[model samples]
Target chain A: MPTCVGVGSPPVMAQPNNYMKPVGSDTRFGAVTRVRGRIDGDGNLVVEGAVEGNISLRGDLQLAVGSEVTADIEAQDVDIEGTLDGDVSASGQVHLGPGSRVRGALRASAIIIDDGARFAGRLECDFDMPAELEERRR
Target chain B: MASTVIGVGITIEGEITTEEDVVVHGTLRGKLETKEHVSVEQGAVVEADVTSNTLMLAGTLTGNVASGERVDLQSSAKLVGNVRTARITIADGAQFKGNVEMDV
Candidate 1:
């Protein structure tokens, strides 16, 4: 909101610009929220609380540490730094940050497990055909 | 800004329990419980029973409401459900179709 210093018209008239700001695309769940159900979003999401349901996003999904989620997740990208007890599927990359503990099935195009990350259950990572591998076959 | 923000273009269908304040600019269709203030902003839609310390509504809601402290319905709001609160205020231009209980 530091942009409150607008072009001398006050913020009331800048409603259109306000709606087009970068904050319009990101959803954040603060440290006190506990949700149970299905979340459908077309943009990125940041979770710092607890959720017991399903999350499906067309963009990135980040679960901060101290957050615990017990549901299934589907997204374009995923970054986890918390505890998750459900399945996860991402069309893009998936990263498990430090201190993340997961116990469920995970599938993504690429997966990265950082140090201090703990994961249990199934993992399915699909890698595209590389030129070197294809050349060796020829 | 409120602690938990449900940005516009997002839709949630489930129960939400929070210990801090919540501001909704999107759509929520389920139960919502909070220990702190809960605000439904303009153009937002909520179809859930709400329990909170304070309630501020500026959108459309179709469910019962229970506030521990007070509840305020803004002028642009459209509410249709029962409301139970110790103190309540309804602004002009707001539409409400529900019973209010003060218990006093």
Candidate 2:
């Protein structure tokens, strides 16, 4: 899988300062790689391999297609297009993209499952119900 | 290009096994085993036993290394461990404190 987090963007001249680093500095675990431990990062992480450990990141997490992850993940945002067998806790949005196969509970601010995605888990999203639905329930 | 890259600002604590090449530019504290080459880039810090076909270090490594082919310690490398390999090269300015077991 290609480890292109933000392709076709303007090249950064210099680091300038912390928190303004370029997007290409994100971490990538390519195919044929297998990690059996815990990953803690302050940058975005893209997985295109097999991971059997927990992932905790301050940035977004992307599980590329053909990737297999069997660990719980905690990130700001999560986008999965692979096979995941663990719970996901995202402070932002959690998207199960096409070709994703997930089997775990998800807790996020918002959750989106694409049409081609296969999911077998419980969702715990925080969203306000429609006023009509709230009145009908009462 | 390396198949597995531990990029900057990332810290991995555990075991990593790969069939392809690996490049570390961050912090790794565990064991690393690879069938191909392994490179520890500059500014990286590795505290683990590394097993690979070919090992190259340009950073700080504090563990044993067993390489099948060769091991190269660049000038910017600071390694403190034993190295067992068929061939080895330690460039000038490399800070190394370990035993070398070459397979003559």
Candidate 3:
């Protein structure tokens, strides 16, 4: 009778494959002049001075404490930590931090208001769906 | 990288237009426009029309949204209005009502 080989031996452990990649870090910064003109940029912006005109950026816009802006702001993201005296428009979200003050109207799809923040103005939502508003009128 | 943060104690009331990312931990009222993404944290209150590529709501919003990509309503979010985008997700416990249209 031929002897059969035992099949109870442990199988070889294969190397574990790791396909997860590390997360990338990005750090960008931009500067704007405190004058009476249009301020536009493609990178992140930090306003630590005064702006007396329109501000347009392709990235995030941050208003530092004690900073003041007297114009409309347009950006992908906006974070106000100081004072704004103009209209604010963003394709993204608008954040209002504590102790922050804003005195103008805002238009965005998303918004946040922290405690102790002061804001006074009109608000409009679902701007992208103008047709809905018209339908309601019917 | 190019990120905007609205610190606490800062207040603004006007129209804002941007093409970058934004985060708000404060208070704001007015119109906001952007081409990227916007995030509203808890304790933040906004009354405006928000437009962006993507939007995440974690606060109180009384307005409409026009997101080119998607709109996410977190568990702590309270929104009332119409939302137009390619995709929409409302987390549990999030308050939202109105019309929603997705891109086909």
Which candidate number has the best TM-score?
Answer: 2
Model 3 TM-score (2 dp): 0.48
lDDT of 2 by residue, B1-104 (tens): 65788878899999998899888888999999999999999999999999999999999999999999999999999999999999999999999999999855
TM-score of chain B of each: 0.97, 0.97, 0.94
Just chain B of model 3: what TM-score?
0.94
Query: What TM-score does chain A reach in every model?
Result: 0.76, 0.82, 0.66
lDDT of 3 by residue, A28-123 (tens): 211222334555544445686566777776666778777777889888777788899998888766777786899998877666776777899966
Better of 1 and 3 by lDDT: 1
lDDT measured at residue B4 in model 1 versus the true structure, 0 to 100: 87
Over 4 Å off in model 1, which ranges?
A1-25, A135-138
- The candidate that wins on lDDT is 2
In candidate 3, position B101 carries an lDDT of 83
Ten-residue region with minimum lDDT total, candidate 1 chain A: A1-10
Interface RMSD of each: 1.7, 1.4, 10.4
Error of 3 at A133 (Å): 70
Best by DockQ: 2
- Model 2 alpha-carbon miss at residue A101, Å: 1.0
Better of 2 and 3 by TM-score: 2
Q: What DockQ do you compute for every candidate structure? A: 0.57, 0.67, 0.03
Regions of model 2 farther than 4 Å from truth? A1-23, A130-138
Tens-place lDDT per residue, model 3, B1-104, is: 46655544334455556657767665557766777788888887878788889999999988889999999999999999899999889999999978998757
Clashes of each: 0, 0, 98
